[model samples]
Target: MRKPVLTIFYQFNPWSTTIGGIQTLINIFIKYAPPEFAVRLVGTANDKTQPILKWQSAEFAGKEISFLPLFSLKNDNVRSLIPTTVKYTAALLGQCFESDFMHFHRLEPTLAALNWQGEKTLFIHNDIHTQMQTVRDKKAILWRRFPAAYFAVESLLVPQFSQILSCNTDAVKHYKERYKSVSDRVAYIKNSYDNELFYPLNQEEKEVEKRELAQKLGLPDDTRFVLFAGRLHPQKDPTLLVRAIAALNDPCVHLLIAGDGELAAQVRTEIDTSGLTGRVTMLGAVPIAQLAQLHRICNVFVLSSAYEGLPLVVLEALASGTPVVTTECGETPKLLTSNSGIVCRQRTSECIADALRKVLQHPEDYPIESCVETAQPYAARTVVRDIYSEMLNRWEQRVTFAVKV
Candidate 1:
């Protein structure tokens, strides 16, 4: 039998050195794609001059997968937005026509490819409405200016997709409730972590790793580390973690920020203003292996995001047997067990500080076994296999129906 081709579209260089949850999820989909199907990826090229419709291939899980990187003008300013959209959409459509199924990782790219008459899937990484309400980035500028247009995309256009997947269970419920017309298509497919790379380290191993990290970052060997590993963007609210660390005011409690982004400057200013200069270390986007090691050695992992779908960092931390202190967002409240971690009642620095203090003061309360157990279900291979099975089943059913018709 000829294998079905699944083409995934998202804006950004997936092959880049530094990537976030969406890109990670894309890679998982490619890596664990059933042997019965072929996969192709469409993403923006790093080089602006990179030609569109040029085919490339990369090996994943001992199999070759096709890649198509499109080029577009930068949409940093308002003047270039329309042209960038048009160019990207045209380029995407040209490549998408031949694929058996299309999977989109972002709303904008999915919106652009709506004209394509094929089986389409949309993955919701974050709640779009919540993002629009809370985020004030370049993308949000247009969304804010045209609320009705955004609503139309959410209400009318979204249901056009054959399937809708959300990493957050709450988001799946939200989509089902809001878009009753396509409720059946909306499902929860969780984000996963590399369990092989992220697992509990023994006490002696952890101490050794901690000492090495301390030496590299020039921190005291006995320092208690609190880690926040994600983009320093408005949605992430990275400064909130900085403020919480300062508010805790424990001389030995140190924060290690592993990622950098748009609010990097602002976060630095907050750290300086709060007099947390030496206490906070900015590692600036460490690799996954390094991040996992940080997770293993840290006293607690913190996420102060204004909103999230389901953060992979939190799962990675749990898999590394590290307790978490995260604001009540997305699936964190449901995801965290009382014996495993703490979820803040409020999104305030004081609340986060108190939560952190509790976890740090009584690490024994959140057992390493409990934390690792919490992360087991989100293991990469298991979740990706389940997702692939679901996609394949749906595709097979559609094909059977088409033949019957």
Candidate 2:
């Protein structure tokens, strides 16, 4: 029999700026996906481009992963006027109509799945319920100032989908409580990382990579940097880390900030106001390969995000054998055992400062072996195989029902 066709609905353009955790997840899925299913990744073009129907990626071992352009509709004139997101949503919906199974990876595609009658699965990266609640507190649509309309629309649609692939226990609980009808269908699969690219570097290897990176980044050899890599936005709480660093008052310690967003000005302002100008360097938006190197070299990886589904940077840090100091977000506590890293008791600067100090003081406590072992379960092959297994079983049940009739 022919392999089951699974059309994945998501957006990503390596040629564009959206290469965050979602893109990383897609890369892993492409890499470790089993051969039992024929995969078609139906992603939207960031810019106006013709549709892309490509062959399998040899690097990823993916089968016929195609990029469907959102703007290229059957009606050219009307397609031009279709709003980009709407066009993207339409493209995903179009693919769902023909595929054996549908896998949605973002909120827009999830909303689009409302119209798709198939054995569909949801892959949520953000806490939608928390976001909607935030909108309520701010009394703004965040979409406009907050979106009363988006909340209403998502409220109507999300509960109807049976199978949801949750990244953490908290997400699974949220889905179960909110949608009791589909509670049994919510499955917990932790996020994954590229084991080949990011792994524990030996002491000799670490020293070399650190020195090379420092030279490339124009830093002194003595700098013991704490790395914070994520968008500098309210949700990510980069300011919290900056505050903690300033409070530490250690001359040997320095802060290195990567990635940029709306809170860039605020972060710079915090650095200047705290008199940490010379110590904090904003290395805005390094390449992913460079990011892996940074993770390998840094004394500690800090994630002060207010929330996350499961921050990919955290996984990458653990995989790179770097100890982490972080607020409890997503699967962080689940991922970090006592032997691996430190999880702060509170979100305040003082609490974070104390945690960082403890980690910095005890280099002997967190072995490279423990960190790598913690990350082993989250390897791309292991997690991706489980997702495929769950999806394949569901598809088989659907096939059985079809055959019965």
Q: Which segments of candidate 1 are over 4 A away from where they belong?
A: 48-51, 60-62, 72-95, 135-142, 396-405
Model 1: per-residue Cα lDDT over 30-126, one tens digit each:
7778888888877666665666668787675466888677774332112243644455666665444446788877566565566777788888888
Tens digits of per-residue lDDT for model 2, 1-405: 678877666555533444368777877777677878776666544444444543233223334454454443332111133344565765556443456777777556566566666677778776656645553124212443546677576568777566787786777888788777778888787889988778878977887877776676667776677999876656777888889998888877878898876668889999999999978889876777778888888888888766777888888998999888888766787679897888887888988899888887887798788888888888887778887897789788878898999
- Candidate 1 contains a number of clashing pairs equal to 0
Q: TM-score for all predictions?
A: 0.90, 0.84
Segments of candidate 2 deviating more than 4 angstroms? 15-17, 46-64, 71-98, 134-151, 400-404
lDDT of each: 0.79, 0.72
Which residue pairs clash within candidate 2?
140-145, 140-146, 141-145, 141-146, 141-147, 142-145, 142-146
What is the model-wide C-alpha lDDT for candidate 2? Answer: 0.72
